[model samples]
Target: MTLHPQSRSERDPETHRAISYRTTGSGHGAIVRLMSPSDLGHLIKPFVFLDLFEGESSFIKGMPMHPHSGIATVTVITEGNLRFEDADSGTGMIDYGGVEWMRAGGGVWHGKEMSPGTSKRIQGFQLWIALPPALENASVDSQYLESGAMPEAGPARVILGAYQGVQSPVRAPDGMNYLLVTLRAGESWSYVPPKDHESLWLSVSRGTLAAPGLVDAGEMAIFEPGNDAVTLTALQQDAVFVIGSATPHPYELALGNYSVHTNPQALRAGEEKIAEIGVRLREYLRQPNDSASVPVFR
Candidate 1:
């Protein structure tokens, strides 16, 4: 099952390509970095920002209240629980290795606080998936799924996407899926995309994964649209990654503090809804990231 044994295409490079990550915010309590989706835009159709967060709480406790709209955010906790509450959604906690998906279709107010009385190190990823024009104005909804509830096939954990004849419990819009994969040392796995799938991208979270050449942690490996199944081998005791997507939902993305959409008009509309939600609930909105801020991409 070693990737080394497979006959790699003559035009392909022999090394696993590293995905560049730009450090955004880091302190004693946490490290925040923006994984460059724009650089690998062609390989990753609609998904963006494989944001990685580590360390402790920096806020008076942790991240305060926030608002969102027009996109779905998938939060996977691997090490510590994340305490969250909203004016209407009620309060809840997502434990270690848990996954919480928030679809801010039209608007929503959400907040995350650290587990009370504990300064546990929280490690997780927030994957941003753009909604199609149709769902862009849909109602907002949130689903919290425990880690054990996610489907697992062999060494991989089916987070939200499908792989190897196994599908995730948390179905996504437009046939898209995102999966968390972990391989024991010396173990290997292979998966074929659904017949209509248009692309596949793999991002290693920890340890070394062999795909023709070894791809270490923090790197992204992309595959061209083809009929062949992808094969990956673990070179270390534990290799974890996020493998996902189904149909290619490619679109021109305009990223703002609280929204990921196709145009400025859409972003403006999203913000208006977010404001309306906050005002209706008597809650204050977190300032949106300045649209004029410098780009983090190279």
Candidate 2:
């Protein structure tokens, strides 16, 4: 994901500093790459890539199988629904507030895991977090969580980390937090980062938000490092968004078309594992029932 810089002439009243990114896409679907490992992602590590996507259910189903390594992907649906299938979890429906977590530790092949639900159109975001050195080459794991299974605090749902004493069930690593929030029009909320959680950013999925500067829908804002609480006011009815905070990742990022690792050696290992899994995935798909568990690297 390439990030073209936007003018930063405005500042949030509370913090008195702000950085913003505008949504850019091909226009075929309302798809946007809000952050990437190269740009804002360098500043906000652990939380690496973020893609905001919405389209007809039929179109989404056409997505081809892809592979990833050295990262964990979080798929959150905000509108419509999707069918999630795996050998371990079987099949489940993911609607609003539902989550699909895939830890492509060493390697994994996916894309056929999700299909259109009952809705005609679907909207959602997929986020990638770079795994730490200890787990970057671990085996793959997955989970499908319904809305009722996720815990909420006030207007925010604890998606990845703890918030206000409520912990998410995602089994994510420590030192990072992700939340999905909805604020009624004219309402306000404040987020105070935990100690050492110096990296903070948010992207709005609908309506407008005022973090001092008015951030319209489809925009993302990165806050300056500080302990100052960030305040946001909804400029329209039911503004929905996701925010993330984390401790800076300590290792350098070794990039690949479909993988991210902490070093060249790890990158090579992950890609080699991916090649080994690809053959198995193809064979599994040829079976009639095709209920085999996704290959996991040990």
Candidate 3:
């Protein structure tokens, strides 16, 4: 298998952090949050942090025009449409239950909105995958993959990675896997990590999930590989979660809003690079990409 377990020196645990965000957009799309990936360094490796946001009003909105570098960001929406427009890359738009992936090779800038209509409920997850050192200084670029375009693996909907021989079109510079899994009530599923990958982390979104043990909603758990595989079962009527695991990589991490890096200097450079790109995106801030775009219009 392309995914194999790493040695003791390699096997690492996933560290979970609280969902914290800053208010960014105007009206209702303003909360901008960062998941601390650098807090754990890079042992389990490819994954940096998991950010969850649910906008209740226009004041607590989504992110606005911002830059990212040395990493990839996967935005998966569960409720409400999210409008996305990037000046550094091309334009993108995605609707309810959509997913937008951007590989900020060097750097890229983007803005997102909450549900444009009156439903008012906007729920989603934004994940960060650290870029390899080679691409840390490259020019920024992005690509969008609709939610429907993502492959399904068993009970799990793959948004940015692969599972059970099924794969997602959203490729990552790092050998990483990001999966969104939803299991029906009383349903049980087993996740066998790719041999090259060692650590597995799961975050519960709704309902209850059980591994060898039970994990309730709003909780995060880390599983160590080499012990066969970890199994998850929905304990309630329905449950959903995001699982991420990948091959270990040797890299440093420095994280700031909208970006992740291997070094502090790189982080500072990324900020400056995006600030420069922000000037370009500002021109189109008022314009909205149509529904055809991969970045959703919330």
Best by lDDT: 2
lDDT of 1 by residue, 1-298 (tens): 0021124453346433222221222223453444444544435556765666666644325455577766888887655666654434455666555677777776666654224214456666777777877776578767777676777777767777666677776646856767777788998887666767766667676788777566777555556565456678889578877777567766777666777776677878888888777675453223454442211110
Model 2 spans with C-alpha error above 4 angstroms: 1-9, 12-17, 20-30, 285-298
Per-residue CA lDDT of model 3 for 124-144, tens digit only, reads: 677777888877767655555
Query: Residue 229 lDDT in model 1?
Result: 62
Question: How well is each residue in 1-298 modelled by candidate 2, as lDDT tens digits?
Answer: 4344446544433464365454442233556778777776677788888888887888776677889999999998888999877767778799888899999998988877788889998888899999998888998888999888999988998899899999999978899999989899999999888978888888888898988777777777777765567888998577989988988889899988889999999999999999988888778667786443343322
- Candidate 2 matches the true fold with a TM-score of 0.91
**Model 1, residue 48: C-alpha shift (Å):** 1.5
Rank by lDDT, descending? 2, 1, 3
For TM-score, candidate 1 versus 2, the one ahead is: 2
Query: Poorest 10 consecutive residues of model 3 by lDDT?
Result: 17-26
> For each candidate, what TM-score against the reference?
0.75, 0.91, 0.74
How well does model 2 score by local distance difference test? 0.81
Scored by Cα lDDT, where does model 3 land?
Answer: 0.62
Number of clashing pairs, model 1? Answer: 3
lDDT for residue 207 in candidate 3, whole number 0-100:
81
